[model samples]
Target: MPDLASLVTVPALLASVFFFIAGSVGLVRMPDTLTRIHALTKADNIALGLLVVALLPQVGSIADAAKIVAVWIVVQISSGAAAQLMGEVALAERDAASSGPDQRGMAGGRDA
Candidate 1:
């Protein structure tokens, strides 16, 4: 008979994989940069948490699982910061292009 742990682990792992696939699709199909970042960060973080849960039973010690969870937390924080930074950069670029001086130089100047 299959052990209870094995049974539970299987589904959790599978769900994690599904989340990964969904996130990937979001990245490919989303219309814009910010939306893509939202998909990747949120979905992948959930998937990572699920993966850590599924892996806990298979690991030799509770300490190992705790370590995995800690890593996931760190990753989530860093990735979130990265995504925010990228969004800000994109916005700045957009603003600069939209508002900057024209190719003709000063606003009152005419073609040479």
Candidate 2:
């Protein structure tokens, strides 16, 4: 019979792949930058976490599993920060475009 770890690992990995694909689709299909970032970040984060979970059972040592989890955590933090920064920039650009040209040069639509 197949081992329990193998059974668990396979499904988790497959789910992770599914989420990664969903994220890519969202990136292409979303209407705007903010929604795109939201979809991609959320999906990718879950996919990465599931990937880490799948890998934990297969690693040879505790240290290897710890390293995998650490990498996942780091990627999660960095991706979230990057997504927030990108969203902010997109909002700023959108606002700039919506505002009249004369207001665009000024900070916060005021004399600066």
Error of 2 at 79 (Å): 0.5
On residues 29-65, what C-alpha lDDT tens digit does candidate 2 reach at each position? 9988999999999999999988998888888899998
Candidates in order have lDDT scores of: 0.82, 0.88
Which pairs clash (backbone N, Cα, C closer than 3 Å) in model 2? none
TM-scores for the candidates: 0.79, 0.87
- Residue 22 error, candidate 2, Å: 0.3
lDDT of 1: 0.82
1-112: candidate 1 lDDT, tens digit per residue = 3387788789999999999999999999998787898898889988888898898778777899789888888998898899899889867766665556575355753222
